[model samples]
Target: MSLRTALIVLTVVSVTADTMILPFYPQFFAQAFDVHSQAHVGYYLAACCISVMLAFPVWAKIARRVHELPLWVITQTLAGLLGIACYFSQSLWQFWLLSQLMLCLKASYLMIYPYVLRLEERDKHLGMVGLFAVLMQLGGILGAVVGGALLEHYSARSLYLWMAASDGLQVLVCGYLMWRLRQGWQAPQSEQSTPTRGWTPHVIRLGLLAMVFYCAAFFIRPFFTPYWQSLNPDSALAAVSISGWLFSLPGWVALLGLWVNQKRPGSDDHAQVLLLAMLYGCVGLWLQASADSALLTIGRIIYAWALFQITVRLELWLFAHSEPQFYGQDFSKLHLMQNVGVILASMTVGHWVSAWGYASTFVVASVGLLLCALCLLWWRQSDSRNAQPSHS
Candidate 1:
């Protein structure tokens, strides 16, 4: 199989194994650790956010030096082992440590995207990126639905065991794919390409903008479940299940979007796509602030749409712009910024919810999204001007 196909398949496995237990994390931590307050859950989640935020950049830089294939092989193996350990974790501390290990493995998955990009024979970068996004979203959908049902009937620990099995499958797939690449790997054809260089002011500015974009988009995610529970504590499990299904719609929507792109090629104008997605996201958040159930459902759908579009574009753009050798580090920095958003969002969102209520919290998130959109618009215009025909 081609490297592109292999990467899409691995993305499915990676997302499935990683997201399988996410729906239950807030409740799981609260119940397992005997924590009562949402604020406490926020703090514990911030621990994860911080650890992953710190760890991915280090891992990315290391992968840039050591190569992604070896990193993938080692991390997946360790992750499967950690998954098993997580199943038997008796204390919250044990669970937390095990979770840290898993995040390391999970974060490494992004490296696979760049490796596949480096390996592809064609220049269909944007199309392949869309495919990767579709697979990831679909995998999350499947994992959440299956996982929620399993959580309904089985112990939460059992979910970890199942996830371990999934990771084991991932390791096998990754190993086989890497071996195949090595059999035919040729650097000569792509090597003539000059690497994009510099820690110059411009490069730094672009990287920082990418970081800010992710941070604003993802900061409040950890609190979504807790917020749902606050609305309906008695039906927390049911609410979670429903929310999982709700979230899955975005994946299906993304798959449809990709399919349409395949049928009728369109502009890969990353800037315009991202700007529109962000605008829609603001609308979604405003709708979410409404007390009406119908309005909330509408908001969820809108939120999913915007998120699916923005992430797909961002991932593709990052790979297209980055030098192959530094793909891992660049993507890792992107992931770190995303986590920073989560950490800050967790701390601030809860307090905002308490002070101004959920409606106000949504408003704040919407405003942040708008501000990010405006910044990206300016960046996009600047980039366009910089793209003027260079003297050949």
Candidate 2:
């Protein structure tokens, strides 16, 4: 396969491996070791999130030192082994440790994102960003669906085997890409940058916004299946597979929104659009929290559309301001921040569900989105003022 094709395959497989167990984490914890505390599942997910988040920066740093494909050949191999180890883990703690290690190793796959950006011309980076975001959402949706199926039909432990196989596939793809690199194909390099220009206020602001925005977007995720099932306890339609599909409704809507945005004209004031999206997201969260009927599904569609808008627009702004040479580092920072949001949500929502109720998470999600919008408001005012002329 061509290098770009190989990289795309690797991205899909790696994302699948990373997220396959996410949809049914509650089930996985309850089934595998018979540790049935929902709080514990939250704590476990939080730890895995932290490991994966911290691990990406390390992988990015390593990619700078070692050639990436060889590094993936080593890390993905280890990651695959760890997945198998988790499959055989006998205790809760053992499984937790093994999965954490596996996640850290698998985090290396995220480096391919920046590598893809570097492969393209600077003008294409925004389009590539949109493509990768769609890929990630699709992978996540697929993983969730597969995870639900595995948990419902197969044992929860089967998730590890699938993850292992996916990682192994990534390793093979890495080898092919490495060989292609050796076939006298020189990778395009972005213009070299001075050290001082690495991270800017604009990038930093976007990272911060991404962290908060992601937290808001995903805060409603962990308890969703249970909540949906609870809402339709007696309905024959409330099967695990159906619940998984509704849970991924936001992703599907986001994909559609992405396609529509690409076909539309580009006259939008992105900052203003982002602000409107935040408002819509908050309203969606409110509707989801306030309703138990089909309004919940409507809320999901609205929330997903808003989420996609924030995502694509933020990326467009981020890459618009960043130098090409800093794509890896900057992308790492953004990815790390987004995971921080996920970690925050995962850490809190489980306990909230355990204590307050599932509705509590949606309530908090709305508040989180509102807070993020306020911050963006401040940022917009500050930028507008700074852009204006000043008498010296």
Candidate 3:
């Protein structure tokens, strides 16, 4: 198989493993460890996030000195072991240490994204990025649906066993990619010719924008299942499955949005779309906060469209402003920034769900979207002169 196809397949398998237990985290917490405190869950999640945020930079620095293939082979092997350790965790603290370590190892998987870019021409960057988004979204849908059903029949810790298997599969795929390279298989040479440089102001702005916007967009994810269950008390037995599917609701909408985005004529409207998408997301959040199931579905659809657009365009903006030599390093920084948003969202949502309530999260998330808009406006003005729009 070609390197591109292998990497894309790896992305799907890895994402599915990572997100399988996500939608039912609350259930996992209660069932696995018999822990019920929302605040404790947040702290644990924050620790996991911190591990991932800090670990990627370490791996990036290592990749600078080491070839990516060997580095990934070593780390992913360790990550698979950690997954097995998670399955055997006897206490919350045991699970915490094991999972945090696993998350840090798995964080290196993120480098695959920018690496894939190096093998493609510059003009197709947005298309490739969008394809990754849609593919990951599909993986998420399958993971959540399968995980929710698994919850009905299996122990929550079984998810870790499946995750370990996925890691093993990733390692085998990585080997295939390395082997093909040795066999004289050649992909398109990237067109980026910019001199290697350190971080620029525009790149920093992009990082900040991603941080704030990602936190805003993902704030409602952790507790969404429980919230949905509360609204639909009738779904007693199939609650896990239904809620899991709902958790992937955004992914479904992302498929549609990206399909239309690709089909539609390309324009230099990335800046306008970036701004408008956030505003549209805010409207969607407001509708979700209405506390009606139908409106919630509609709101989710709207939010998904906006979220995926921002996600694709942000990377488009990053690569357009960044240098090829520093793709891994710059992307690591961006990864860290996005994780900061996730950590913030996780902690704050834990509090909001405990103190304020689930619906309040939507209102606060919309406020975040507005804040992101303001940041985007600032970034756009500063970057208007130096960078050309990245459109086909």
Candidate 4:
């Protein structure tokens, strides 16, 4: 396979592994550890998110010094090993420590974006980024379905083993790609430059946007399984399977959105797209907050469609604004902000769910989404005004 194909495949596999346990997290904690507290689940997830956030800049620094292929190979291997060890963890504390370490090593995959972008021409970046997004969504879909099946037919331990297996697959793929690239690959001239730019206004804006967007999106994640249980009230296995399918609904919707985007290409109205997405996102969150379970599915579909568009455009925006020479570090900084948003959401959403209830948290999340939309609109208008010619 070509390098691009390999990278895409690696991304799909890695993301699949990373997301497999997500839909069943609440169930896993409840069954395996007899822990049912949303707050504890949030704390555990927050630990992983914070670890990834801390590791992003460090990984970026290392990427600047080491070759991408070798770095990826080493990190993927270590992460896989750590994941396997995490599966054997006997206590929540032990699992948390190991999972945090695993994520820190796994965080190196963030560099893959800049690495892949470096391989393609500037004009192809958006298309490539969109392709990556589609693959990611597809991976999530597969992960959810398969993970649910595992949980139903086998055990939560089996799901962890599957996750470890995915990481192991990533390691093998990265190692092979490294060996192949070693034969003929040459570093780009831009790679030699010292990256000096740090936290430009554009970068800060993007970071702030990421922080808000993810904070809104992830607030409901840790409690989703429990929320589904409250709605469905089925047997454990049935609930796991049903919720998995429910989670996959968004992936299907996102795929449709991707198809729509493809049918009408060359429309670079990112601001407009983002505005529409956030509008839909707010509606979706509100629907989810409603007492009807059927509305929850509709809400997920709308939200997923919106999320798909926003993620593609956001990455494209970041790539367009970043300096080529500093792509790795710049992308890393973006990842840091995104993870910070997740960390904040995971840390605080539990308290909100614990106190006000899940429906109230969704209302707050909808408001947050609305704020992000308004902020983006303001930024776009300001940019347009600045670009106009001055009449003397």
The best candidate by TM-score is 2
lDDT of each: 0.70, 0.78, 0.81, 0.79
Which prediction has the highest lDDT against the true structure? 3
Q: Per-candidate TM vs. native?
A: 0.82, 0.90, 0.88, 0.88
Which tens-of-lDDT digit does each residue in 1-392 have in candidate 4? 99988888888888887878876777888877899976776777788788888988898776655777777767877777777787788898888888888889888887777888988898877677777778877887777767767877876756767777777788788778767766323344456455666888888888888889989887876666667777767556336667767756666776776677666674577678778989998999898887688788898788888788888887788888876778887888888898988888878887788688867877888898899999999999898788786632
Candidate number with the higher TM-score (2 or 3): 2
Error of 4 at 117 (Å): 1.7
Give me the runs in candidate 3 sitting further than 4 Å from their true place.
Answer: 183-198, 232-242, 381-392
Looking at candidate 3, the ten consecutive residues that score lowest on lDDT are 183-192
Residue range 1-392, candidate 3, lDDT tens digits: 77788888888888888989976677788988888877786777788789989999887766665656666777889999999999998987889889989999998888888878988988878788888889888988888777867877899889999899889988877777677676322222332333345667767787888888888877887777778888878756337767767677778887886777678744556778789999999999998887688898888888888888889888877887766667777888888899899888987887677788988888888999899898878767867754655531
**In angstroms, how far off is 353's CA in candidate 3?**
2.7
lDDT of 1: 0.70
Candidate 3 Cα deviation (angstroms), residue 193? 14
Off by over 4 Å in 1: 65-67, 178-216, 219-243, 294-296, 380-392
Error of 2 at 263 (Å): 1.7
Show the colliding residue pairs in model 4.
none
RMSD of each: 4.2, 2.7, 4.3, 3.0
Task: Report backbone clashes per prediction.
Answer: 0, 0, 0, 0
